[model samples]
Target: MEMSSIVLRMSPTLITNVRIFDGLSVVSDCGYILIEFGNIQQISKFPLPTAPGWNIVDGSNSTLIPGLIDAHVHVYQDLKFIETAIQYGVTTVLDMHNESEWFKKMKLVADEKNDVADIQSAGLAATVKNGWPSAILRMTAAADATLETRISGWPDITDNETADQYVATNKAAGASFIKLMQEDGCALSLPFPTRPIPTPPLEVQKAVVDAAHRNNMLAVAHALTNDSVLQMLHAGVDGITHSSVEPINESVISAFKDTNAFIIPTFAVHASSSGEDRHTRQRLAADLADTREKENFLGCLHIMQAGYSIQNSYEQITILKEAGVDILCGTDSSEHLVGTRAGASVLHELWLYVNRCGFTPIEALASATSKIAERFKMKDRGIIEAGRKADLVLVKGNPTESIDSLNDIIGVWRNGERVVWE
Candidate 1:
C-alpha cells in the first residue's frame, strides 16, 4: 500500500474494535475511539456511528494504548532521534539536559511535524565547574571540540545567586523543568582527573529546587548512589532521573517517602554501564540492518564500578514500587549513549520492569504512560479520555498481557495524524 493511503489526515478517524489500555489499566476489552482535529473527540465501549469522510481502521485483534513516554532522554540537536522515536510508539520524551539553542530547533521540529515525538527539555542542567557529565564527557567524547565548547558554556552554578540565575535562564529558554546534576563520578569506573567529581553543595541544590518551584517548574535530579539520592531528596526536588546504582536501603526509602518524589529509573543506561543486559540488547537489535545503528545498540559502556550491577537497580525499583513511590519509565537513550537507541530502548526498559523487577505487564505499561504524565504534570496526552491529545499506538497483540508485544507496532498517531513511516 502507498504510504499516503494509510495516512490519516486532519479529518475525523475512527479506530474500532480494539482493546483499550487507557494508560492506567485495561479500560475496555473492545472499544472504539474517535479522533478529530488533533484530539480524542470521544471513546466508547460500544460502536460509534461513522460518516462517509471519516477514516476507519478496523482494529480487530489489536490493542490501542496511550503513546509511550520516555521520561529521561538527552535529545541534543538530533532530529532523527525524535523522528525514529515516534515510529516505535514513543510519542513524547523528557530531555534531561540539552543546549538551549539546539533544544529550540528541536522543539520547532516537533511543533511542525506530526512524524516526530514531542519533547519537553530541561535546556541546561544545574552544573558546577568540572562536574558530572562534563567529567564523563571529557573521558568519552574529549575529541569533539564542538561538544567541549558547548560544555564550557554550561552554567557554573556556585551559590544561591547562581542557582537562581540558572533556573531562570533555563525557564526563559523554554525549559519545562529543572535538571540538577548530583553526580560525583564515584560510581563510574572511568579514570577521571579527580577521583570524586566536583558536585554542587546541598544548599545550592536546594536553591535550584526552590527556584524551579517558584517558577512553577519541577526539579528533577541525577544521582547514582544512595547518599546522592538522599541528598537530592533532602534538597526537595520532585524526582530522581536515574536509580541509585548502589543497593536499596532504608534511608533511601524513607527519604523518598518524606519528599514524596518519583523515580524515572533509566534502567536501559544502567544495563549499558554495568555491561549487563547485552543479550537483551542483542535481541532488541536483531532486526536492524544498518551497521552503525546495530553497533550503537550492541555497544556497552562498562563504566560502572565493580560492585555496581543492574540487578541492584532492579531491586531498587522493586522496593520503591512496594513503598508506594512512583516509577516512571525512561531509558537515558541518546545519540551517543551506548547500548540504547531512542524509542527502541523504551521497549527494553519496560520489558525489564516486567520480566526482571517482578512488575506485571500492565504496571510496566503504566510506568511509560500515565505515571509519567502524572509525575511530569503533562495533562493532555497520557490517557484515552475525551478531549485528550490523540497520541495513540496500535499494536498487533495486547501489551497489557505481554510486554514484548509492544514491538509489534501496527500504527502510531501523534496529534490525531497518522505517522507516515518511510
Candidate 2:
C-alpha cells in the first residue's frame, strides 16, 4: 500500500502481446511496450527480453492506448474529482474555467500525486458585468453566499485596458490558457435576470483575444448559439469550447474554416442540456453504488429551449468534422453541473462521437487523445512513443473497433505507476 513500493514495482514494467493504438492510429496488432523510470523505454512488434525485478503484465486480447484526456473539465477545488477521473483512464483534464486560487491548490496535488489526473487550467474566464456563468450560476445556486461572493469578484471587463489586465493577471496566476464567455442565454430555457444576458461587446471580445495572444495563451470561447460562435471566430479566438445547439449552417462552417480554429463540441453537456441522452448516461453509470453520484449522472440540465435539441449539436459536430475542422474531445464536466461526472463523462462524450456523430471509433479515440494534446499544445503525453510519459490505458477488447470496449478497463497507468482503482 505504500506509494514508494507501488512506484518501485510498476517501473521497469513490461506489457506484452497487446494491440496498440498509438493515438493517431493502430500501430501494432500484437506488440510489447517497456516502461522504465515513469516513461516508455521501448515499444515494438518483436519480443523484449525480461529483466530482473520487472513487473510483467500479460496484455493478451487487450488494446493499449495512450491515456485519455478530457479536453474540457472544471476541476474547481475537488481533489476527488481528479482522483476519480484517473480511475476511468482519463490521465489528463483540461480545466476550462476555475477560480485561480483553487486551481493552484489542485495543480500542486496533480504535480505531487500520480494517483490523480494531471490538470491544465484556464484560471478565470473573461467576463462582463452580467455575463455567462454568472447568470447560469445565479440560476443554479442563487442561495449560496460563497458563490455570490465569487461572482462579485469577477472582473467586469469593458474595454482593451481591462482585457489586457485580466489576461496578464490570469497568466501570472498560472492559467494555461484564456477562456472567453459569449453566452446570451437565449438558447436556454433558464430564467435569467435579463432575457438576453449581457455579453461582452464584439470589440471587448477582440481585445481579450488580442491580449491572450500577446500573453502567448490560446483563447477558447464558450458559446452555445450560431451568432455567438460566429462572433468568437471573428474575434480570432483559437477554439470554440462548445458547439452551438441551434443546428449547423453553412455560415458556421465557413467561419470555422476562415479562422482555422478547432472545436471541442462538448456533446456530453449538450445531451444533458436537452435531456436527450438519459439512457446513455444511465447505461454508463449502471455500476455506480453511490446513490447521489448515480443520480448526478442520470440528471439532465434540461436547459435547452423547445426548438433547441442535442441532435442539432450532433449535426453541427458532424458538419464541422466533415469540413475538416479539428474536433477535440471535451465534456464540460464539473461537480456543480448536473448530468456530468468528472472522468466518466469523457467516456460518454467519446461514445456520442462514434454513435451520434459520424466519427469512426478510431477517430473518436483520437479526438480524446492525440487531437486534444495537439490542439492544446501538450507535448509530453498524448501519443504512445518512446521517451513519452507512460500514461496509458489497457482495455480488455479492441476499443479501436468498439468505442464501448473502453468501458472495460483492465488497468490504467499514470507516469508508469499503476492506479489503484477504488
Candidate 3:
C-alpha cells in the first residue's frame, strides 16, 4: 500500500475498480475515471496509461460517487472537519458565510483542496439588522427570554462584522458568490410579529443581489418562509436555502415555482439531532422524554406538509418530485457534524427525502450533483462519462440501486489525486 513519498507531479491519474454511477447511469465493475490537472480528463472503461509517469490507484471495495458536493457547509470552522469530509468522500464543501479577509484565507487553504475537497464560499448573509445570525452576526449577550426586549430596543441595524459591506468585500477578496437571509414575520413570535416575518426590505436585498449579479455572481438566500421567499424572487435572487416547515399563502408559492428559481433545503442542519447544542446550558436545555423525538418529528412532518408547496415552504420537498422542482444537496451544518460520518449526512438526507419526503434515490443524488452543476453553471464535474472531470468517489457497492451504498465509501479522488483517507 506504499504510494510514492515524492509528491507526484500532476499528470494523469487512473482510478479503477469502482461501481460508477456516471451521473446519467450506473455501471458495475466498469467504473474507471481519469483526471489530468484540474479537469476530469475522461471517464471510461478502466482508464490505463497512455503516457508514462502517470499516477495510479486501485480502490478497495468502496462506493464511488462523484465525490459528494455538500453545497452548504461552514468551511472556516476546522481543518479536522475537512479531514472528516474527505474520509466520507466529499470532494467539495461550499461555505455560505461571508467576510473578505476570511475569504482570502479560506481560498488559500481550499483553492485546490490541498488537504480537503475544493472549497468555495458565499459571503456573510445579507439580512436585516438583528436578523438571521442572532448570535454569530455580532457579539451579543441577549438571552432567549430577553430576545423580545432586545429586538424592540435595538435600532434597525447591520453590523461591520456582517454588514452588506462585508459581503461585497468578500467578492473582491474572491467569494464564489453572495448569500442572503430574509427575515419575515414567522420568525418572530409574540410581540415580535404575528405572522411569518417579512423579508429584508426589498431595497436592501436588491443592493446585495444587484452588486453580485453585476459582477456575474450568484446570490442564494435563506428564504424558507412564504413571504420571505417571495421577496427574494421579486428581488431576482437566484437561489434559496431551507424548506418551510410551516404554511405560507398560495399565491406566493406559485410565483416562486413559475420563476423556476432554485431552492436548496439545507435539511441536514435542521435535522440535526438535538445533540448538537451543548451550549443550551443545563438551565435552558429542554430535556428530552422518550416520546419527545417522535413528537418533534411529527411536528416537523406537519410543517413539511403546510401551504402551497406546503404553504410555499415546500416543507416536504419530495412531494414535488413529480413537479420537477429542481432540488440540490446542501448540509448547512457539515462543520458541526464533523466525523467520518458527517459526509454520510448527505446520503442520510437523501434517505429522509425518500422515506419521509418520497423522492427516488436517483432524484436525491441528482440534487447533489447534476442539479448543482446546472444551477451553478459548473457543468464539467457533476457528472461521470467520457471527457468529464475525474473528481470521483469509489464506494464499496452500487449507489444507483441503493444510495446507502454511498455510505460505504472506500476512497475519493479530486482532479485524479487519490485522496488517501486521513
Candidate 4:
C-alpha cells in the first residue's frame, strides 16, 4: 500500500494548549509544540503566533507525551499488528524474536511513511537443542507437525564458535540487539515439563554475550527462574527480558545491583499464567473501542490456562525497584502468543507497576519511553524535544495523574504525520 498522501500536505503543524510529558515528568502548565519536516522544531511554554504554512491545532489543555515503546515483542509476519500498536499510541516496538528475512522486510516498512509502529528486532535469537522454544512449539503444534520445519530455521548453538556465529548472523541481518534464551520451560510454571528442560550452558551464553559486546550490540537474555537468571547474570548480559519467577531474595537483589543490569519483567505474560486473564480481558474491553483487539484478547484468553505465579513475579519487581534496579516496559505481545495483545498491553503493564509493583506514574511512563530508548540505544525518538522525531500521542486527560487516562487517546502522530486509525 502507498504511504498516506494527506500527511504530505500537513507539515509545519503547531499544537498549542497541551500538557507536555517529555518522557520524564509532566510539565505543570500548558505549552505548545512545533513540528516541521518530520521532526520537532520547537517546544515552548508560551504560545507562539502561527505562520502562514502552519496547521495549528488547539489541544484544549489535553496531555501530549512521547509515543510509547514496547521493549519486548515477537512480531510474526502480520504488518497490521504494527498498525494496531500505533492506534494505541505505541510508536515503536523492540521485537525479541522473528525470522531474519521477515524482520528485514518489516524494518523496511518501519522506515516508510505508513501509519505503523516502528520495529527494532533481534532478527533471530540464539537457542540450543531441545531448549525452551522447542518444548513450547511441541506443546502448541499439532501431533502431525514436522519438528524439523519448526526447529531447523532456528539458530542452535553448541559452543563458543557457534554462539559467535549466531550473533554475527543476527547483526548482519540488521538485528537491533542479541536475544539469548536461557529458560528451562519449567520456569513457565506449566505441568508439561515432566523432566528437566534443556538450555545452553553458561559458557555458551557468556560467549554469545561477549560476541554481542564485540559487535557493540546489547545482549538481552530470556530468563524466568532464579537459576536461569543467575546463569545469565554470570554471563554478563546487558539486560534480562523477564524477571525471576522465584521469590526475590537478598542474593538476587545483590546480584542485580552488582551487575547493574536492567530488566524488562514482562509481567503481562506472567499475569496470564497466574490466572488473571478475566481481569485483563475486562480492562482491555473497557478501555479500548477496537473490536479486532477485543477478539484478539479472546484468543489470548485461551492461552492463559496454564498456571504460573504472578505474585512472585510482582514481588520480584517490587524488591528490584527498592534495590534501584532499572526497569523497562515490555508486553511480549504477538498475534500467535497468548496473554498479550500488542499496543494496548503496554499500558496495562504500567498500570501493574503503579497499582501493584509500587511505581509512581512518571516512573512507569519513563520505563516505556526514555528508559527503553536509552537501554536499546535508540538515540533519536524517545523524548519530545526539539530535533527529535515527531512520534507523539495526544490524550484527553493527564496521564500523570491517572495512567488509565492513556486509554483516551485523542490523536497520534508518527514522524510528524497525524495517524488516523481507519
Candidate 5:
C-alpha cells in the first residue's frame, strides 16, 4: 500500500481513529489525534472539523492503538532489523540479552541511521560465578596457543561486594537495565546439556539488584526455574524475565503475586532443541548425546503441562491483575528469528495470554504497551495522549475484543512519520 510522502511533511497530521485505547480504557468514536514533530499535540473529540495545513485520514470504522512496544528484541544483531519492526508496528524494543554498549551505539545508529525500531539496551550480561557458558570456550587452539579470551566484564561474583561492582560498572558505563543470568544447566531439554544447573548464589543476586537500585535502574533477572524465581524475588529485583516452567503450581504463582513481581514471559522462543535460548541462563543442553534427552524431554512435557494447566486452572493471569502484579509482553525473538523471531512471534505470545491465560484482548495489549512503559520508567511513548510520544498504529479492527484483529495493520506512525509498510 502506498502512502503520501508529503503527508508527513505537514507540520500537523490528524489520525481520526474509530476506536482508541486511552491507556486504561477504550475511547469509542475517538476523533483525530494531532501529531506534530513526532509527539502527540492533541486528541480532539469526534466530528471535529479538519484543520488547515494538516494531513487528514478517514478511519471512522477502524481501531487506533498506541504503537506496540516489544519489551524484548535484538535489533542490533543485523542492525537493519528495525525496519522489520516498523513494518510490523513495533516502535520500541528492549534489547534484553545483547552486548550492552554495542547495542547502545547501534540504537543511536537506528535513530539517525534509518527510520526504524527504537532500541534500548542492557549492558554486558551479569551471570553467576560459573554462569554463561560461551561457545568461544569450546574452540581449541591449533595445537599451540588456544583461543580462550572470555568477554571482559562478565563479572563472576559470589557475594555482595563483587556484585555491587558488576552492576555499578555497567550502570556507570551506560546500561538501560541490568540483566542477570540467574542459573546454569537448568534447562535440561536443551540439545547439549548433560546434567543439572545451579542458581546464581542468592547473595550475588541480591547484591546485583541492590546495585541496580542504587543506580536508579531496574534489574531484570533471567530466571526459568521456580527456585530461581524465588531467589530473584527475595533479592528484590525489578523484573523477572520469564515465568517458571509450566505446571505453575498455585504456590509458585502466589509467590510471584505476593511480591508484586512482574514476569514478562517471552513465550515465542521457548525451549530450543539446541543451545541456550539466547537471553538469560547458561548453556542449555541442546539435542542429545543419548536417549537421556527423551526422559528429560518427557519430564519437561509433564512440568510444562502442569505449569500451564495450573497457570490457567488457577487463573494466574486474573490473579495477577487482581493483586496488581504488572504483566508485560516480552518476546525473546532474535533479529533474524534464527531459533526464534520472524512473523507473528510477539503476536503469538499475546495470543497465548488471551487464549490460554484468560485475559481480555485489550488487557493483553496493555501488557505489551503501557505496562512496559510504566515498569521500565520510560517517560516517553507507550500511550496515546497529549504530551506523549506520537507512536501510533492504525488498525482495521477493534483488537480490544479480539487481539487477532491486530493483524489488520493499516498504517504505523513513529515520531509522527507514516512508516512505509511494504
Candidate 6:
C-alpha cells in the first residue's frame, strides 16, 4: 500500500464543530467528521465514535466544504501550479489542454501527498492546421527560427482519418477526455488583431466527438460564439468549455435546454481579458503576494485593455443558469496566461457566479464541486460524505452567507492529508 494509505489506515483524523457543506446540500445537523484511509468514514451531529490514536481537529466557527475543483485549466509540466492550487483550497484541477509528452511525468506526482492538487489533463487538444491556438502560439512562442517549427508541431486534424489518429494518440498518452478547439479568436462581432484563424470543420469535429464516445471518453469543445456553440452542439459534444458572448436569445437558450451538454463558462477569463469586473481584479490584486503573480495580473490587465470586449457575458451566463443548463466553474488559469492566477482565480470564478450571474452561494459552490464531478464523470471526490475521498477545505465564516468568506481559507485537505500551506 502507499505510505499515505498506510498512515490513514493507522490514524483517523476527526474534525469537530464545523458547518458542513457536503457538495449536494448543507448539513445543518453535522459538526463532526471522521476521515481515514483517504476517505470520509463518518459525519455526525456530535463527536463520532472513534478508536484510540485518532487525530482530532477543532473547527470552531468554521465551514467545511469539498475542496474546490477548477473544471477548466491549462496545466504546465511544472508542479508549482499544483502546489499553489493546494494552498488556496483547490484540490483538483481538470486541465483542458496540455502537451502529451508531459503526461507521464505529470501523472507520476498527480496523487502524491506532497501538497499538490491532483490533475486530470486532456493531453494536447485537437486543433486544425494553422488554427485558433496557432496565433496564440505565435505570439507566445520564442521569436527564434524554431517558432514556426513549434507552431507546426500542433496536431492538424483535417478529416476523420486524422481525427481518429489524434484521438488514438491522446488516448495512448492517457488523456482523460478529448478537447476540441472551436475558437475562431474573435469575440462574436469583434475582430482579432491578426487575421482570424479557423476551427476544425463541423465534420471533423463531429468525427472526433464520435470517436471519443466510441472509446468511452467525453468530447469537450472550446467555443466562444453562438455559431461555434451551435456547431459543436450539433456535432454532439458533451460539454462547451467557454460561454459564448454572442447574444443569448430564446432560441439559443432553448437549444441549450434541449441538450444535456454542460458549460464551464470560464466567465472570470472573459472578465479578466476584457478588464471588466474591477471588484474581482482589485480583490485578486489585494490577495497576491508573489511578485510574479502581481506582474502576471498586471500583464493580463494590459492585454484586456487592448483586447476586444465580450458584451453581456454576465447576462448570457445568467440566461443559461435560469434556463436550467448546467454551469460549471473554471478559471482558464495558467502561468503564461495573463489576468488569472493559478489557485486564486477559481475563487474569482465562484465570486462571479454569485455576484454577476445571480447564483446563490450554494448553487455557485455546487458548480465547482458536485456538478463538475458529475458532468466530468469523476467518481466520488466532489462531495463530503461517507465513502467519498477526503478532499476538503475549511474556511472561517459561512460562505453561504457571504461568498467572500471563501478567501479566509484556514485549512485544506486532499485525500485526508492536511496541506501544509504555511
Give the per-residue lDDT of model 6 (tens digit) for 1-422: 26565454657899998899988788953499998887898888877776788778888888999989999987768687888888889999999877776655766776555478888989888988778676666655457785576557768999999999999989988899999998776663334455567777799899999989998999998987777888888889988998876667666687787877899888667766676665676676785777777867555432332334545667888988888899989988876677777778888888888887899999999998999899999887898889988899998999877889998999888888887855
TM-score of each: 0.97, 0.97, 0.75, 0.93, 0.81, 0.93
Q: For model 2, give the 10-residue run with minimal summed lDDT.
A: 1-10
Model 1 C-alpha lDDT per residue in residues 331-356, reported as the tens digit of each score: 99997688999999999999999988
Candidate 4, clashing residue pairs?
A: none
Off by over 4 Å in 3: 1-11, 27-29, 46-63, 135-168, 188-199, 273-315, 337-342, 385-389
- Candidate 2 residue lDDT tens string, 1-422: 25456556554989999999999999999999999878899999999999887889999999999999998899999998999899899999999889999999999888778989999999999988878888988888638779978988887899999999999999999999999999889999998989899988899999999999988899999998899999999999999999888877889999999899999988878888898788988888999999999998899888899998889889999988999999999999987588999889999999999998889999999999999888888889999999899999999999999999988999999999888865
Total clashing pairs for each candidate: 0, 0, 30, 0, 17, 0
The TM-score of candidate 6 is: 0.93
Which residue runs does candidate 2 get wrong by more than 4 Å? 1-10
lDDT of 4 at 354: 89
Poorly placed runs, candidate 1 (over 4 Å): 1-9
* Candidate 5: residue 56 lDDT (0-100): 84
Every candidate's lDDT = 0.91, 0.91, 0.59, 0.82, 0.65, 0.81
Clashing pairs in 1: none
Query: Stretches of candidate 6 above 4 Å error?
Result: 1-10, 141-150, 188-194, 301-311
Error of 5 at 327 (Å): 1.2
Model 5, 14-130: lDDT tens digits are 777567886557866667677876678877775656667778877777888887887776554565567766666777888776665567677666566325777787866676533
lDDT of 2 at 80: 85
Candidate 4: list runs displaced more than 4 Å. 1-10, 141-147, 189-194, 287-308
As a TM-score, model 4 comes out at 0.93
